[model samples]
Target: MSSLVASAVEYMIDAGQRSTLFLDVLRQRGDQYREHVAKTAPHVLQYAAELIVDGRDLIEPVNYALVRIVPPEGVQIDLERRPFVVVDPRAGHGPGIGGFKADSEIGVAMKAGHPCYFIGFLPEPVPGQTIERIARAEAQFIETVISLHPRADGKPCVIGNCQAGWAVMILASLRPELFGPLIIAGAPLAYWQGVHGKYPMRYTGGLLGGSWLTAMTSDLGAGKFDGAWLVQNFENQNPSNTLWTKQYNVYSNIDTEADRYLEFERWWGGHVNLNAEEIQFIVDELFIGNNLAAGKILMSDGQKVDLRNIRSPILVFCSEGDNVTPPQQALNWILDCYADVDEIRAYGQTIVYTVHQSIGHLGIFVSGGVAKKQHTEFSSNIDLIDILPPGLYEATFEAKGEATTSADLVVGDWVMRCEARTLDDIRAMGGNSPEDDRRFATAKRVSEINLATYRKYVQPWLRNALTPQMADAMRNLHPLRLQYHALSSKNPWMFLVKSAAEAIDGNRKPVSGENPFLAIQERMGKQIVQMLNSWRDAQEALSEAVFLAIYGSPALQAAVGIDPESEPARPRQMSPEHRMMLDKRVAELRSRIQEGGLREATLRALLYIGSARGMVDERSIAALRQVRRDHAAARLSLPEFKMLVREQFFMLLLDPEEALAAIPKLLPADDSQRRAAFVAMREVLAASGVVSGERAVRLRRIADLFGVEGDPQLSNVTSFDRDARASQGGENSQGLEQHHVG
Candidate 1:
C-alpha cells in the first residue's frame, strides 16, 4: 500500500513536469515564429553576407544578386585556385540554405581554400525580370567572378541547387566559355520524366487542368505571384511529415531540437515573390511544355537554348529518395540532349553523374553529410574534372578511414572516384520509355488546350476582380502564413501564454524518456502520422489515375496533336564541313603519332590506359596534378594540354592498334625516362588501392608497349603506403615487375 502511494505521487510529478516543459516549448516556438516574421519583413537574408554583384546595377537589371560569403576567422582564402559559385534555388523559399550554417555548400568551398560566391535574389522580383534576363545577369556575374580571379587556374566551378540548376545549365549552354565545370544538385531538367504510380508530383499539372491555374494565380496576385503557393505544394508532398511528424519531433525533443528547428523555419518561412512573367515562362517552357530539353525554349534575344552547346564537364548529383525531383527527372535530360556515348565523345563533352541511395530533395543541398563528402570532394577535384577527357562517367565515393562511435563518423570520411558508364547504365535507372514519352506529349497538348480555354474565358474576369490590396490580403491570410501570424506574440491572446510559459521555464522539469504516458504520446503521434500518410497515398493515387485517364483519351491525344504511332526524332546529322573537319583532325592526329617528345608520348600512353580503364579516381588525379607541379616538362597550359589530350584521343579512335604500337617511338630512347614515365603511370593507377581486370589488362598492355617492367616495390601499394615509404627514405621510382603493372 505504501509503494502504490509513492508511485502515484511520482506519476503526478512527472505529469506536471511534462505539462510545464510542453507549454514552455510552445511559448518559445511562438516567440521564434514572431521573430522570424519580423526579421524577414524587409526582404533580408537570414544569414549575413555582403553583396558582390547587384543585378539591379547591371546593364540589364535583374533582381538576382551575387554575394561573397563571409568565412569564419582562421579560414584563409586562395585566389589562385578555382573559385566556386553556388547558386541557391529560387523556388519559393528565400536564399541561404546553401550557406545557412558553417557546414554547407558555401562553407564546404571555403574550407577547401577556394573563394566562394553565392547567387541569390530579392524578395520582390524586378518589374519584368524574365528567365532570360535572369540568365544573362547570372552570366555577367560569373564573368565578373572570372575577371577578379585572373590568376586562378581555371574558370569558376559553378554549382546550381534545385531551380538554379536548370538556370546554370542554360548559362553553361549559352556562355559555355565562362564555366570550368558544372554541378547541378537535386535539380529537375527533364520535367516530365517520372514513374506513373510512384512519382505523383508530375501529375499535379495535369490534374489541376494544366498551367492555367498558375496563370490564373499570377493574375490574382496582380502582376507578381506569391511564392507561398509553391511552398504549400512542397509541404503537401509529405503530409505525414508536414501534418504531424515534423512538429511532433520538435515538440518531443524541445530541449535539443529548438535551435535547429528555428533556423530551418527562418529560411522556410521567408517566402520570395516572382514576377508573373517569370512563373508563367517556367511553367510553360519547362514544366508543362517540356521545351528546355527539347531545345525549343527561345531566349529573350530569339536564340533557342540548346544544351548541346554546353562544353563544361557536367556533374549531376541526384538521389533516389528525392520525390520532388526524382532521379529520372534529374538525369533523363541526358537522353534528350545526346544521341549516344559516341556523340558525347565526338563533341568533346564530359558528363559525370552521382546518385545517392537515400536523401531527399532539400537534403541534397542542405544536408551536412553531403556538404562534407560530395561537395568537399567536388571542390577539391575541380581541376581534375576540367582535365578529364570527354565521355560519360559515374562518380562513386568509398570511405577510407577507421570506424568511430560518433554521429559525424558515418563509415568514416570518403574518397571520390569515377567509373566509365554507358547510356544503357543510365537507362536502367528509371529512364523514360517511348510509351511514357507519348503520355507526356499528350499531357503537353492537353495543357495547351486547357490554358487557351482558361485565358479566353477566365483570365479577363480574374484581371477585373483582382486588386493589389486584395492580393496582398489573400497572400498574408494563406493557411501557411496564418499559422505563424495567429500564434505569434502579435496576437493579444498569446500574451497570457507567454507569461505562463516564462513562469514555467523558470521551474520547468522535462519528463523522463521511460515514462508510460510519454510512450503513449509517441504512439499517438505515430498513429496520426500513419493516418495522414494514408490520406496522402490515396490522394496521390486518385490524382495520378485522373491525370492518366484524361491525357490518355484518344480524342484528347488527337486534339493535342500527338500521334500514338509516331517515334521521337533522331539527332541532327553533322554538316559536310563539320565531317570534313573531323576527318582532317583525325588525319592530323595519325600523322603526329610519333612526332612529340617524351612529355607528349607519356601522356598519350596514360590517356590510352585511362580510356581502357574507362574511369579516373580523384586521388590518382591529385597525384597526377602533384606530378605536374613537380615536373617542368609537364607544365603545359590548359589549352595546350587539352589539345594534346584531344589529339591522342583522336589518334586512338582512328586506329587503336597503330596508336598503341607508335607509343614507343614518341618516347625518348633513354631507358631512365621510359622507366620514370612507367613508374608515374603505375603510381596513379595504384592510388585507389584497388585493381580491376580492365585496369590490370591496360597497365600490362602499356608496360608491354613501352617494353618496360613495372616496379615491384610499387605493386599493389595504396596511396598511404607510398606516402609512408617516401617519408622513410624509400625509393620513389624503383623499376617495376615485368608481368604485373602495380
Candidate 2:
C-alpha cells in the first residue's frame, strides 16, 4: 500500500477508538446529570458551605437561599472584615456558577480573608414566589449576614452575577443601607440599548411578535415556564457551540476534559422552572418595557425601583465578546437614568465599569483566569471603591512590567486603574438611534397587543388543554432535557456505551497530533462552525430587516401609539425634592470647601491632582490606603471617608481654582503635621507617574500652595519621606498651613 493510503487507514482505526471513548464520556456525563437531578439539593460549589438563610423558610417563600462558604483548610476568614455576598443569576440553570470551581468569586473573596455568602436558588422555584418576595428575602438574608458579623468594618460587598445583577439592584435601591460596594458582573440593565448586527437576543422578542409566545408557552407548561425554553434560547444564540463545538471539544480532548465538562454540565443542564408570574414580569417589566433604568417598575408596594436610588458604588464588569449582555447593555443604564455625568455626581452615585476586550458572557464569571484577575482586584479595592468620589469611571488594567514604578505596591500581575469617564464616552459605544428606539417602542406596543390577544384567545385553550401530567411530560421531553435522559444509564440503549467506553478506556491509543485524518476532522469542525455562523448571521439579518419593515413604518408606529416623527423619548425626570437637594448640596459643599486641616487639605490636593490625571491607579489608591493605616487613631470610618471624598471632589469640580486657593485655610497651624500630611499626600501623587503636561502644571501649583519645593523631584514618595525626616520646616517651611494659598 502507498504511504498516504496506509496513513489514512491507521488514522481511521485511531479515530474509531477515540469516538468510542468520547461516546462513553457522554454516557458518563448523562449519568452524572441524572445523579445531580436525583438529589433533593444540589449545588456545584467546589467548597464547603452551610445554609444561613433559606428563602423557602421566609414568610414569602422563594427558592433562593443564602449559604456561608466555609473557608478552605489553608484559608482563614477575618471575622471583622466586610463580607462578600454573591448572588448568582437565576436565568435558567441552577445556582453555583459563582462558585463553580475553587477559583470562583466565593473562592477569591475567601482567599482575601473576607467571609463569603452565596445566594443561590434550588432547581425548582417556590410555587408562589414573585420577584418582589425574592428581593425582600435577599434583603433579609443580607441583614442576617450583617448581624452575624457585627464587628465588620463595612457593609457586605454584594456581587450579582448576570441576571442576579438586576435583582441586586432592586434590593439595593429599596434598601441601599444594606449594601456596601455593589459588583454587577455581566448584567444587562439597558435591554433596548444595543448596536445593530449584534445583540440578536434582543431581536428574539421582536421577531416572536412580542411576549405573546412567552404567555403561550407558560400556559402550555401549566402556568410554569420551563427554564429549558430559556436554556434553549441561550443555546440557539450559538448553534455551533450547542450542536457541535461544545461536544467536539470534549471529544477531541476526552482524556483530560470529561470531568471538567461534566462539572459545567451539572450546572448548565440543571434547568429550573420559573413561576409564570416571574417570567412574565421579567419579559414585560424588564426586557420588553426596558423600564428598570427608566425607573418605571413599581413594586407590589407603592415603591418604584429606581436605579438612581441605589447609594452603594456600582462596579460593572462586562466583556465585548459577551453577546448575551454586551458592553452597551451593561452601561447604557447610566444614560437612561441621568442626562450627564454631572447628574450622576449630583445624585451622589459612583459607578465604575470595566470592559474586557474579549471574554464571553459566562467567562466573565466562570473563567478561572478572570476570577483571579478582575475579581481579585475588585475585592481587594472594595474599600477604595466605597470611598471613591461619586461619578462615572472606567476601570482598566495594565500588566505589571519592568517599567512599573512601585511594582511592590501593586497586588498580583495587573495594575487596576479607574479612569474618569463622561456620558459622551458611553454614547460613543453604539446604541439605538432615535429611529431604532421608536422601532423598539413600536415592538413593545405590538407585544402588549399580541399578549392581550393571546391571553384572551390562545392562552385559555392552552391552560384548559394542558394537564399537569402533560406539562411534566413536555418538560421531560424538552430537547435540552431529553438528551440527558436518553443518554443516561437509565436508557437501555446507552448500556453498551457505558461498557464499551470502559473497555476502550482500559487500553486507549490516542492519535498523534500530526495525524492527517485528525487534522482533516478538526478542519471539518471549523467548517461546520463557520456554516452555523453564516446561518445565524443570515437569520439575524433577516429578522432585523423584517422587524424594521414591520415596525419601522410610520403607520405601524402610529397604530402602536408611538409617533414616528417624534424623537425617541427617554423617560427622564428629577423629582422636585431631588432637584432641590442637589442644588442645596452644591451650596453646602461650596460653603465647606475652605474647612478642615491636614486630612482635608491632603484629600483635596489628591483630588485636584487626580482630576488632572483623569485616572486613579490602584497603586496610587494603595498609597492612600497605607496613609489611612498609618494614622489609625485619626482614620475616618468608610462612610465618613466616602463623604469627605465626595465633598472634596465636588468642591473642586464646582470651582477648581477657588478649591485650590482654600487649601491653605483648611490646614492647621502645626508645621510638622502640615509637612507630614504633604509627604503622605505626595505618596499618592507619586504613583500617577511623571507628572508632565497639565498634571505636572497642577502638581507645581499644588506644591506652591503647600509652600514646598515646586520641583518634580520632590514628587517621589521615598525621597519626600526622607526629606520630611531630614528637615522639619526647612528654609521655606512656613508650615503649609501658613503657606496654604494658590
Candidate 3:
C-alpha cells in the first residue's frame, strides 16, 4: 500500500511538471514568433555578412553581388589554391544558405583551403534586370574572382545551387574559358522530364492553364513578382509537413527544436522579389519551354547557349528524392544534349554526375553531412576533376573507414572514384519517354500561346490598375507575409500572451516522454498527417489527370503545333566546328601514337586498364602524382600533362590494339628501365584498390606487349622489395632491387 502511494505521488508530480513545461513552451513560441516578426519586418538579413572581395565594387553592377567568403576564425585559407565560387539560387528566397552554416558549401570549401566567393543578391533586384543581364553580371563576378587570384592554379571552380545551376550552365556555355570545373547541385536542366505518377510539379503549369499565371502575377506586382507565391507552391507540395508535422515536431520537442526551427524559418520567411521580365523569361524559356537543354533558346546577343560548347569539366550533383528537381530533370539533359558517350568524348567535354539515393532538394545544398563528404571530396579533388579527360562519368564514393565495424557514421576521408557511364544508364534513372517529351513540347506551345494572349489581352489592364504603392500594399497583405506580421508584438493582444508566457517559463515543468497523454497526442498527430497526405495524393492525382486531359487532347495537340503521328525530334547534332575539332584531334592522335617514351607507354597502358574497369579512385591518382613528382624526366607542366592525357586517351579510342602494341616501342630496351616502368604502373593499379579479373588480364597483356616476363599481378609489383623479401626468406631489400633492375 505504501509503494502504490509513492508511485501515485511520483506520477502526479511528473504530470504537474509536464503541464508547466507545456505552458512555458507556448510562451517561448510566442517569444520566437515575436522575434521572427521583428527580424523579418525590416526585410534585411539577420545574419552578419563580411565581404571578401579585394575591392568592394561590382565590376558590372546588376542586382547580384559577389563577396569573398570570410572563413570562420582559426580556419586558414590558401589563396594560391583553386578558388571555389558558390552561386546560391535566386528562385524565391534571399541569398545566404550556401554559407548559412559552418558545415555548408562555403564552409567545406574554406576548410579545404580554397579561396571562396559567394554570389548573392540584394533585397531588391536592379530594375528591369533580365536573366541575360544576370548571367552577364555573374560572368563579370567570376572574371573579377579570376583576376584577384592570378596566382591560383586554374580558373575558379564554380558551384551553382538550385536556380543558380542553370545560371552557371549558361555562363559556362557562354564563357567556357573562364571556368575550370563546374558543380551544379539540385538544378533542373530538363524541366519537362519527370515520372508521370511520382513527379506532379511538372504538371502545375499545364494544370494552371499554362505559364500565363506567371505573367499575370508579375504584372499585378507592377513590374515585380512577389517570391512568396513560389515559396507557397513549395509548401503546398507537402501538406503533411506544412500543415501538421512541422509544427507538431516542434511542439513535441519544443525546448530542444525551437532554435533550429527558428533559424531555418528565418531564411524561409525572407522572401525576395523578381522583376516581371526575369520571372517571365524563366517560366517561358526554362520551366515551360524547356529550351535550354535543346540548345534552341537564343540569348539577347543572338548566340544560342549550346551546352556542348561548355568545355570545362561539369559535375552534376542531384538526389533521387529531390521532388523539386528530380534526378531525371537534373540529368536527362545529357540525352537532350548529346547522342552518346562517344559524342561527349568527341566534344572534349567531361561530364561527371553524382546522385544521392535520398536527400531533399534543399538538403543537397544545406545538409552538413553532404558538405562533409560530397563537397569535401569534390573540393579535395578539384584539380583531378579539372584534368580528367573529356568523357561522361559518374562520381561515386566509398567510405574509407568502413572496415572498422565500430565506425557507425562513416564520414570524413572518403575514396572518391569516377566510373564511366552511358546514356542507357541515365535512361534507367527514369529518363523520360518520347511520348512524354512530345506532351511537354505540346505544353510549351500552349504556354507560348497563352503568354502571347495574356500580353496582348490582359497585361495592359493589370498594368494600368497597379501602381507601385498598390503593389507594395498587395505584397504586404500576402497571406504568407500576414501570418508572420499577425502574431507579432505589433499586435497589442500578443503582449498579454507574452507576459503570461514569461510567467509560465519562470515556473516551467516538463512532461515525461512516457506520459499517456503524449502517446495519445502522437497517435492523433499521425492520423492528421495521414489525412493530409491522402489529400495531397488525391489533389496531385486530380491535377495530373486534368493536365493530361487538357494537354493530351488531339485538338489541343493540333493547336499546339505537335503532330500526333510524327516521331520525336532527333538529339542535337554536333556543330561543324565540333566535328572538325574531333577530326583534327584524331589526326593528331594518329600522328603522335608512336612518339611517346616509357612514361607515355605506361600511362597509356594504365588508361587502357582503367577503361576496362570504368573506375579510377583518388588513391590511385595520388599515387600517380607521386610518381610524376619522383621522376625528373616524367614531370610535365599542367598544359603539357593535359595535352598528353587527352592524346593518350584519344589513341586508345582510335585503336586499342595498335596503342597496346606500340607500348614496347616507346619504352627503353634496357631491362632496368622496363622494370621501373612496370613497377610504377603496378603501383597505380594496386593503389586504385583490388584489381578485377578483366583488369588483371589487361595488365598481363600490357606486360606481354612490353616484353616483361613472369606473373604481373599488381600486388607483386606494388612493393617489389617487400614481395621479394617475403618470397625469398633472408633476402634483403638491396638484393631484390638489384635482381629486378639488373
Candidate 4:
C-alpha cells in the first residue's frame, strides 16, 4: 500500500484498539459499579424502606414536627418576626435539598432569626393529589405561617427553587395577597426561550412532538407519572457526567467522595411521581406553550394567570452555564409580558435578576458558595429588593472585608448591589425571536392531540393493568431505585461482595495527582464535548430551519389557521373597576412619594439608579446622603429644596466642582451645626474617594465661613481613617457621638 493508505490503516487500527481498551475499562468499571451498588444499595434501600414503612416519620420527622424545623445540634430555633417558606423543586427528586445543608437558604433565614418553614414532600405523591391541590396546600401553609407570625411582614417570603419557581409564580398569581417577596432561583419562566444553538432541552418538546408523550408515559404508569423520566432527561443533558465523570470522581476519591455522592444521590435517586394532569399541564401550559408570560394560562377558577398580576417583587437568580434553564429562559418573561419598563413601573412591579457566569442549574440552589453569596445576600437584602423601583436590574455580589456604608448589610460572605439595565439590553442577550413562538405553538398543538388520543385509547387499559403491587414493583425496579436496591442486603450477591468491597474500600488509597493526565483528559474531553455539542447545534438549526420553511410557509400557516402577520389587537377597554383600582394604586403611590420627604425619595432613587449601574462606590451613596442632609438642614422651602437637590445631583453628573460648591448652600445656618455639617460632608466625600486637595480647600473655605477652623493637613487626608475624629472645636472629640447626616 502507498504511504498515505498505510497511515490511514494504522490510524483506524489504533482507533479500534483505543475503543476496545476504553470499553474494557468501562466493563471493569461497570462491575465495580455493581459491586459498589451491592455494598451501598442496601443502606439506601433500608433508608428508603424505613421511610416507606414509617411513612409518617419518614415524610414528616418529629424534629420538623413543629412546622418541621430540625435545628442543628447546639442551635435553638429562634423565630423572627418574618416567616420564610422555602419550597424545594420536586422536578425529579425527593425533598430536603433546600435544607440539606445547615447554611442553605433555610439556614440563612433561620440564622437571621426568621421563622423558617421547609416545604417538602414524600417520594410518592398522595393518592389523588393534583397540582392545584398542591398549590392550595402551599397557600394554606403560607397562610398558617402568616397567622402564626402575626407581627411578621405582610406575608412570608416564599422562595422557590427550580420547578418550584413556576409553582410559586402560579400560587402568587392565583392568590397574590398570600405571598411577600418571591425569590425564584434557576427557574425557567420563558421556557421556550434559549440562546440560538444552545439549550437543547427546549427543543425536546418540538422533537418529541409535544407533551402528548408526557401524557402517554403517565398513562403507561397507570395514572402516576414516572419521575425517573425527568431524571433520565437531566442525565442525558450531560452524558459524560451521568455515565463516567460522576462514577470516576467517586472511584478517584473513593474514601471521601463516597459520603457526598451517597448523600446527594439519596435525594437525587429518590424519584417522586407526579399526577399525569400535573406534568401534562406543566409541559403544555408552561414549557411547550409558553402561555404563562403571554397571559394565556387560566386557572380552573377562570382567573387569567397573568404573571404581571403578581404584586410581590420578583427576584430571579440564573446562570449562563445552566443548560437546563439558561439566563434567557429565566429573564425573557419581562420582555414577553410587558410592552416597556414604564408598564412594569406602572404596575408597581419590582423585578431583579442576577446572572452568574458559570454555575450549573443545581448549584444555583445547592452550592454552598452560592448559599453563602447569592442566597445570603438575597435573604439579607430582600427588603431592599422589595423597595426597588419598577425596572430591570442585575444584582451583583462582591466579597469585601470592609464594606462602604452604601453596601447593603448582609449576613454572610458578600454584599450585593443592584445595577439597572434597559429592557433592550436584556433583549440583546438572545431573545428577539418569532421562531420560538412558532415552535412552541406547534408543540402545544401536538401535545393536545397526543394527550387526547392517550386519554381516549390507552388510559383504561393501563389503569386496569396497574395494581398497587405492580406499581410498587415498578417503582422499585426503576434504575434510580435499583442503584439503591442492588446495594442492599436484599440482593443475593450483595452479602458476598459487601464485606470484601468494604475491606477493599478501606485499603484502597487512590493515586493522587495534580494529575496532568487527568487534567489533559478533562480538557480534551471538554473540547470533544463542545465539538459534539456544536454538531448537535448545527443539526438542530438545520432542522428548525427546515421546519420553519415548511410549516411557517404561508400555505401551511393558512392551513393551520395561523395568521403569521396578524397581531394581537389592542387590549380591550379597561373596566371602570380596573381603571379605578389602577388609578387608586397610582394615586396612593404618588401620595406616598409626596408624604415621604425628598431626602427619603432621593435615597430611594439613589438605590434604584445605583443598583442598575452594577457598581456603587462609597462616593455615590455618601453623596446621596450628604445631599439629603444638606437639603434638610438648609430647610429650604420644599420646592426650592427639591430644585436645589436636583441641581446638585445634576451637577454631580456634569461637574463635581459645581455639585460640591452647591452643597455648602444647603448647610445649616447655625455656625456650630453648619461647621459640623461641613466636616461631616467632607468625611462622606473622603470615604467615597471624591475628596481631593482642591475639594478639601473648597470645603474648608466653606467651613471657615461658619467660624470653623480647618486642619492644614485636611488637604493631605487621602484616606478616611475610620478611627480618626473629624475636627470638632479644633480638637478631637474622641467620645463624641458621630451624627449620621443621611
Compute the lDDT of residue 505 as modeled in candidate 1. 65
Residue 55 local lDDT, model 3:
21
Better of 2 and 3 by TM-score: 2
Local distance difference test scores for all models = 0.76, 0.83, 0.77, 0.61
lDDT of 1: 0.76
Instruction: Please report the TM-score between candidate 1 and the true structure.
Output: 0.90
* Model 1 misplaced stretches (Cα beyond 4 Å): 1-48, 402-412, 568-584, 637-643, 690-697, 707-742
Model 3: residues >4 Å from true position, as ranges?
A: 1-60, 402-413, 632-634, 637-640, 668-671, 705-707, 710-715, 718-742
Pairwise lDDT winner, candidates 3 and 4: 3
Indicate the residue-level lDDT of 179 in model 4: 80
**Which number leads on TM-score?**
2
Ranking by TM-score: 2, 1, 3, 4
TM-score, predicted candidate 3 vs. hidden true structure: 0.89
Model 4 worst lDDT run, 10 consecutive residues: 732-741
221-253 per-residue lDDT for model 2 (tens digits): 888899988888888888889898999998888
Query: Clash pairs of candidate 2?
Result: 664-740
lDDT of 1 by residue, 1-742 (tens): 7755655565566566555555545556666655654552233333456778788998879888888776678888898888899887889988777787777878878888999888888778888788889988998899989998998877889999999999999888889899989999999999988876777998777777778889888998898898989999999899899877777777677668867776777788778889999998989888888888878887767876888878888999999999999998988888877777777776778888999999998899888888888988787777667777777888888776643212132222666667777778888887556766777888777778888999999899889988999999888888877877777666787777667667766775666666665677778888998899899999999987887777777777777788877786555554477578767866777787767777776777676655544567676766676677778755986656766776766666666677778888777778777777788877666565543454455566677666664556444421233344344353221111111111
Model 2 spans with C-alpha error above 4 angstroms? 709-742
